[model samples]
Target chain A: MTVDHEPVSTADGGEPRFSTWTGKARGWALRRLPPDKLLPEGQPSYVSSWIYVFGMGAVAALVYIIGSGIVLALNGPTWFHVSSLGRFINSTHLWSVELFFMFMVIHLWGKFWMAAWRGGRVLTWITGMLAFVVSIVTAFTGYLLQTNFDSQWIAFQAKDALNAVGIGAWFNVADLGQILMWHITLLPLAVAVVVALHVVLVRMHGVVPPLEAAASDAQLSSATPNPATESEHRK
Target chain B: MLGIQQTDAGMPDPGIYFQWGDFLIQFGNLVVIATMVVLFILALVIPFPGRRSRK
Candidate 1:
């Protein structure tokens, strides 16, 4: 395989930096969200709450889930059934997924209480919810890939549900090949993209302050330099 | 009713189910849910350590 490491353009012409597509895209991204805000060194003091940890915990669990899942995918379903090492990895993948959901659910609960969608953060909330929905589907497809009696039973039950909802036309839960592809590829990719977007939105908007801190920030917007609003206004 | 059934193979028998009226859930799922609830409560109640400021 040939490696193309050199820059596409070598000539130091007098063209404007933003003339190229990459330059223009960079300019747009930087203008929308500066580097400092995208990766802040410190958050507001109001973020000193244990509830904030669950979001990161969920992300960590997702990392483990994906890593273990990659191993399982490499080994295939039969390896997991026959090999002890494969079985261990499969169990690791399963437990990681369970932990991921647990942590994500707690994060959701915390965000719900914090009114994390406040201050034009509707997209962030929507993306998070979308990730949750997609993760559920991903996990369901994973169950169907287990290739056991439980999987068979779940597939039959889910087929009827999908049929009732008219999704059976395009999506067949009984089809192992189709479900395996969904479990291992499509749904996971969707989850990753949506979760990444959610995180980017959170960083773009900054973490939502506590309700009382937000209310006070509004009341003292004129008198004091509200760091939260200051960042918003700067943006 | 919540105990795991152990078979002669020494493996914990799977498919332990708990039901209340028409509602049904695996005991393991119930444990997960309960643990999540507890963790959520503790997270809300517990104080998070603040970052140390540079002197």
Candidate 2:
């Protein structure tokens, strides 16, 4: 048998080799960093503002809610009703949820008025808004799972409203077992999937540049035109 | 089966009567809804700073 020892080279005379696991892992880590950290594409000097903090605050609230919720789930619903630790976990989850919604809504609205959807970022904004709506419904289902007298009344009332809106047939609010399953399983899964998609979209498009800075610079300008100027022109 | 047994447990069962759980659920729901509405209104009311013209 003849032993062939030929070096692999590309048409351009460069060495031809597949990326190793280390190379791929390094690329992944680099891609995961925030825009300010990873890339040389510097943020505009005008990017500093209190308005920028709400999005991060919303993310923090989401972290708290998910962590507390997991603890509550591990203890089980019945334990939440009986055990002190479980009750505290449940309450923490509840408060975290409240905070999450508060911050999320503020972030969403701020982004809207700031025209943060410019620069081909509409899809990200839309996905995030859908996630917000889904989260609200999930929270509603969670309340019903408490299996308290409050849950019973809210179930009846909410069922009536849902029936009036023509969706009650699909989701029986009165069934504690059903509500619990949806809360701990279906709804959270949906939220997680939507959130993943939202984050991926955000990463792909990158954060929307501050309106003033982007309109002035117009460097890596996207298809979506400056919203402020367009609105002004309309006026 | 559970539902059938629960139904057989009677209308005036102590669990169903004077149920604090039901009251709490109602209260919680009301408070959450009210808070969401108030926040939404506040969001609409708050005027965001105008973007400076890019000269």
Candidate 3:
């Protein structure tokens, strides 16, 4: 396998890694959100707001959820559903999801209360919300994969709801194998992708400034930064 | 009765509401879960249209 690391130029036809669509995307990301901007030594003083902890908490809980989920997945349903150690790991996975959802809800509420879309951070807010919605779907599919009476009941109930919206035909919540695949593979992959995009946008946009700080910055701008009226914005 | 009402067949019917007075004997996970879900959708849709920020 030959490794071509050089930038692709259409003129040279070498499939440049830095000039193609993938290259352009990487370059755009690096230019728009440098590493220093993605992670900083210190946050804005206004970021000391306690509500911000919810976002970190959500991320931390997801780490635990994914780790425990991996353990359970490796053990397989036969073990996790029946064996003592497997059950323990299963419980841990369940609680991690609960924790994740709790933290995410608090984070959402906090962002909403803060009007986190301020300061031209609309895409950041949108990405965050999309991640949340995807996470919820992931969590739901996990519940259906539980292999228990509760899962059975939930599957029956959820299938009707999905059917009502024309989503059931595509997803078929009552199908055991389908839900297992979704819970273990498809949904998680979707969640991870959405979450990554959300994080990228968060890094690119910078965290939403507190209302007071945002208002002051608007007033301080020499270019008359009326975010309320401006169709475009500057960094 | 609320929560899981038993059918003659041994399956449970998740109730939406309950009736109780002296102490409180019933709760419905389905209704609560469904309501919270609907609430999430409403919460998402209510504010700005997700296109742009506004004061």
Tens digit of per-residue lDDT, candidate 2, span A1-235: 9855443456865334335666555556544543543333543334344455566677787778878888877877688778888888888888888888877876787788768777677888888988899999999998787666677767887999989989888888987778878988898888878877777676666666655564546543432235466456656
Q: What is the C-alpha lDDT of each candidate?
A: 0.80, 0.68, 0.70
Specify the CAPRI tier of model 3. Answer: incorrect
Model 1 chain A: ten consecutive residues of lowest lDDT: A218-227
Interface RMSD computed for candidate 1 is what? 4.7
- The candidate that wins on DockQ is 1
Sort every candidate by lDDT, greatest first.
Answer: 1, 3, 2
Model 3 spans > 4 angstroms off: A1-26, A217-235, B1-55
* DockQ metric, candidate 1: 0.37
Candidate 1, residue A210: Cα displacement in angstroms equals 0.7
* Sort order, DockQ high to low: 1, 2, 3
lDDT of 1 by residue, A1-235 (tens): 9843332443654223455667777767875577886777766666677888888888899988888888888878789878999999998889989989999999999899879898778999999999999999999999898888778878888899999999996999999999988888999899999999999888877788777775656433432335576777866
Docking class of 2: incorrect
DockQ of each candidate, alpha-carbon based: 0.37, 0.08, 0.07
- In model 2, pairs of residues that clash are A148-B21, A148-B22, A149-B21, A149-B22, A150-B21, A150-B22, A150-B23, A150-B25
Candidate 3 per-residue lDDT over residues A1-235, each given as its tens digit: 9865676466745334484677779877776776876775655544554566667787888888888888887879889878999989898888788767766876787788779897677887888888888898888888888677878888888888888988888899888888888888887888778778787777666777655565556432422234445434432
Model 2 accuracy (lDDT, Cα): 0.68
Task: Please identify model 2 stretches exceeding 4 Å from their true place.
Answer: A1-44, A218-235, B1-55
Which parts of model 1 are misplaced by more than 4 Å?
Answer: A1-23, A214-235, B1-14, B50-55
